[model samples]
Target: MADIAQEAGFRKNQKLKDALLQHKALSRQGFSERLFGLLFSGLVYPQIWEDPEVDMIAMELSDQHSIVTIGSGGCNMLAYLSRSPKKIDVVDLNPHHVALNRLKLAAFRHLPGHGDVVRHFGMDGIRTNSKSYDAFIAPNLDAATRAYWDKRSIAGRRRIEVFDRNIYKTGLLGRFIGAGHLIARLHGIDLTQMAEAKSLREQRQFFDARIAPLFDRPLIRWITSRKSSLFGLGIPPQQYDELASLASDGSIAPVLRQRLEKLACHFPLRDNYFAWQAFARRYPKPEEGTLPTYLKAENYRAIRDNAERVTVHHASFTELLAQKAAGSVDRYVLLDAQDWMNDEQLNDVWSEITRTAAPGARVIFRTAAEKSVLDGRLSPALLDQWSYLEERSSELNLEDRSAIYGGFHIYVKKA
Candidate 1:
């Protein structure tokens, strides 16, 4: 009965379909969109790729602020709880993401200690995690969320059992990383060597010696040139075009190579868990490297105490903001979702954002290209209401540990 209910929920995700399907079904672009929609309809990000540390600084988050943000993988929202925000309305088109967000909130509230929280989310492939879920976390979840996790996956194990053996290895992004590892292995390169580098110099040497050559390989260039190859990264056709246009040769290989180079060389591996995930496929052990803000031991007590402030909504960010009163929200974290929007969609979301923004409210988002996506697409009136912090955005974009996005933008609502 739970499985039936879950299947119904997955099939009925009209909002997701509406967001992804812009072209006719028979066209190649349309087919790729549908395929991405299908893959994204399930769990796409086991952990979101954006840097929450940068987001916090961009928003100037405070206890008095009310925030509305897209909830991808739920990590950043939980991290925001550390700030003791007055409210966090987390909206997502994906029901699985909604469930995952709710589950994390419940875990923070119910799980006994910081170690237990780390065990559940930070570590990968622990057989005891399901036991902990059944005993501690499951009972605290809402009925729908509980049913969603209780439902079995295609592997004949309950969805909750993913924690029993590397939950991070189960999602679309996880499989994408795994595929990348396999490809590297086939070419006689060990991707994990990047994680072992002790300094920036070592990191750069490893990238030049081992990783840079992989991008120039004929097979790799061909695979990356296809739009479908990036579905695992949650990049849509429009964003893929933007990414390819950045390279002089108009191939995604050089763009991807540059991004991976930043990921490998810009920060010490000992401090970047994002690097750990990219190269090691798992977060570094506690004394080895850093974890996301939400998973850090020091933030656990605050996150647990403030977990109730977060409310996960299974809907679009625009729809959710439209329902709020004017001047109600103080902060907005859009992630890289704006890269997926068409002109109308961009205008619609920004309209609501401008309408609902409080005095001096801030909005932050990322783009696949090295400029704000809203430059000309949003109506002039709406665009004029916000001040783009271009210099600060560029500075922080470099500081972003994830290093996946081409640009990070900050817009402050004109008072």
Candidate 2:
């Protein structure tokens, strides 16, 4: 087995390494944290929660720009490639994520056509995925990544076999979503039916009649109270604490309810694949106009041609930024990773960010709280070197179709 530590990408930085260990140790507290840790240690997000379309608009990428981003499920990074940036360096602490990203990159490059790509990733119930993997994706993967997917489980099937079944229903987040469907079923709410709603009015009505009622259930409230239940959402304990602090009465259920409302009712169900995945556990059928930019038929060729521009790294953002020469990077996508950082870790990360950012460098990230974390956490001197695009950030935050995060922020390095 690949050493989880090395794959975690923390060993390069002593501070980050220490922070990771501390979180792991603290996760031993009780059944909740332990279970959360176990879930987090594996693939947490089957797809990224943050909207890459919002990110692409916010980043304003060009061939002159070099971008670095956190690779969660590798979806957004692949989506970002559609913009044809100079290069995209995708960093992730999870080896599974790293492997997943590499697999996606290879799939885009080696898959025969857009239909095949769609078949491999977009739809489920395909019996040819394993054969497709062996024929196309496997040869392109590095040995470590290949071994990770090739490893057999107790069921006597290689882990990659999941793609043949339903990749969307396989990861920690996937199963968590599946469990949610079960709960919805128990309450007589058909989440799949929500996907078929015709309009926002219909969506809201369905949410109110069928889905919203489940939020009031005693079991859901009890489950949401525990930090462990959110592991499937890819929320770490530290992030849970931040979310709880923002929530009234220190209960996360209300916050989750509000977010779910936005996800289900705020956007047209036909166009919002994020909501579809949450409610239905998969993207809309290929016939539906809604799909991630990377998956759309029109962008496939561009993504395939530019797929080589993405390089996956098993490292922290700071570690990757430290390796780049000063002012070499023009765009940075942090996701919600700062929510997991301590002040020291944040400083370390932003320090490298400032050091490597180009003249017009823009950094974009999401947070569990509705405000940017940089204001109170980082040193004023360091923070002052970058200008917060407050109005633009707020506008983009509103434009974020994902509707899961509390805030979207953008900062540009000052001239």
Candidate 3:
């Protein structure tokens, strides 16, 4: 059996070593936690849940900024590249994510133009994707990344074949979204209808009539009640508990219902690729104007030109920050990784963050719960060094098209 560190990508960080080991041990105490851990170790998220549009606004990223971020799906990393940051150092515990990030970077660098890259990633059933990979992307990939995609699956097809097939349906989140469609089908509800909604009223009516009813289906209730079942949504046991705690009846379904409603009704389908993926299981049509910020036709040149600025690593955020000189990094995007940590782990990461953050540096993150965990968790002195942009965070969270997270946070280093 693989050790927790090996599977989870723990290394050389004194602060995270024992803490992660203990967390792993606790995860092993229950079957659900262990199963979710395994799922997490694999490809969990095909795309990030946080909204990069809100992130961009909150960070005010520019050519002068250097960013350090957790690379989940590498979507936001590419999104940040559009601003032409000095550099983006991406770290993730999953080796699979590291490879995916590397592959995306290579594609951006070597693909002939914007349309090729968009069709390769944004659409399914493109026969030329594999050919494009062989001709352009494969040669540029690192040894490990190349080997990962080269390995064949049980279907006797290389995993890289997913690009030609449907890359969105290939990861844990993709599979989870696919499962939701299957469940909806069993109940005689076609979620794809939600995508056809012309207005917010129509979206809500569709949800109330079709998608919303599925939540009450006995099968859905049973599956959702089991903590193991949500791994595909990238909700670890800890986050599941946080979400459940927020529900009055201690059921996650209600919280999820509200979020799904926001996803379907709060934004137009033409501009929300997240909804396109959830309901239609693919990004919006290229002409639909709803692609991710990085995938936009106008921004493609900037993204391709700035591809070399990113560096991917399979390491902990704290470990990478410790290696950097003090006051070097200008932006930090932690996603929801901090919710998986205890207070000690939180303090340790914040210590490195404070140490490495340049003057006027900004940090952004999201939480599974409505409030920031750092409020009562970190020491007064450490917390005092930064100012929490509560009003701004709330405002931006409203604009976050992803609509999945409970809160979005922004903290700026004090002058």
Candidate 4:
């Protein structure tokens, strides 16, 4: 049976709305924000965009660390589990994300093995996943999380049925990628061809011949101009502004093209699962390519064993940190979420982070632009307590396989 109180609390999306609604209700920006909140209230990222491998290096994760992070898709949390962290408190404003994290945790704890785990998360269109959920995963889930999956979506199927098809192909990000594929198909270009490239040169040749031309089309530029156009990429109105500013001519097309170039040509397709997701829309077979840290076969047992150390909270990071003891957290992972925050919100989060950070704590985050969002935004008093790793951040930003973010940043608490 569902815990009525827990279910009710999780169902309310007002906290998400409050965080996103920054302008007057009648304003265009306000409408866009609210619309994003609506779409985002459901699933957003099927997989988190930030590179956890880079994160592990930046934070220097060890068995001694206790991490508190914004749980976008729960991939990072589970990936961190492979490090055997002492504890990880995963907080998110979206109830659906909270449910998803809990579901993954339950899967790790109760599923038969790595193969079953992959069947549930890695591959797509496996109808038996619902059965697996019923027999193993569901029984282990909390009342609220169990009720969430059992509930029917608008499609008149249980939310758990997402695994029955392609779980990775169902979220807002998934639908956005699907739309991109549709748009490309209409242009006579199969974006998936990038996945077939045998080498970097081949990848660049395909991008130049097929992909680069589309960005220059009048229709493409026109569509990318609208703020609403990027809602699918999970770029809120504010972050859209930050991203648009990166283009010299104030067109997002060039910026997007540059990012896509990195995804297509910067790394070998066989090793970059992020590239697989962007071009192939699915992870490659085990023999064909790599996977996220948490999904890899070698890390499965460690993740499953450490699964009990994570606690998922459906609340803002700041709110969760407020309830924790001062100096309790050793690491923080904020994944481009600060790009959506106003100055006050930034300061509020930083205040909590500074107050709760343990000695020698490290924080890693990404941004839509090429500099720390904290500069000229967060209070100097709060910001001064941390030393920004500008050089290391620049190197890691280039190394991040996701290729979407403009910058990856790390800040260490002053000893």
Each candidate structure's count of clashing pairs: 1, 0, 0, 1
* Candidate 2, lDDT over the whole model: 0.83
The lDDT ranking, best first, is 1, 4, 3, 2
Model 3 stretches astray by more than 4 angstroms: 1-30, 287-289
1-415: candidate 3 lDDT, tens digit per residue: 3345334543433333443343444444355555566566667777887889899999998999999999999999999988999999999878778899999999999989888888888888998898999999999898899999998865688878888888888778998999889988888888888777877788888988888877777788778877777878888777888888887765578888889988988888787888988998888775664788878887888889999999998789988998999999999999998877878889999999999989999999999889998989998989999999999999999888999999999999999
lDDT of each: 0.90, 0.83, 0.85, 0.89
Which residue pairs in model 4 clash with each other? 125-165
Once superposed on the true structure, which residue ranges of model 1 sit more than 4 Å away at CA? 1-11
Two-way lDDT contest, 2 vs 4, winner:
4
lDDT of 3: 0.85
Per-residue lDDT of candidate 4, residues 73-183 (tens digit): 899899999999999999988877899999999999999999999998888878899999999988788899999899975558998998998877877799999999999
Name model 2 segments beyond 4 Å from true. 1-35
TM-score of each prediction: 0.97, 0.93, 0.93, 0.96
Which lDDT tens digits does candidate 2 get at residues 1-415? 3235333533443433444443444445434444445556677676888888899889987778899999988889888877788899999877678889898888999888888888888888889999999998899888998998898876689988888888888777898889999988888777888877888999899888887778888888889887777887888777888788876665688888888899989888888889888877778885664787789988888799999898899889988898999989999999998988889999999999999999989999999989899978999989999999999999988878889888999999999
lDDT comparison, 1 vs 4, better candidate: 1
lDDT tens digits, residues 166-198, model 1? 877768899999999999999999898777787
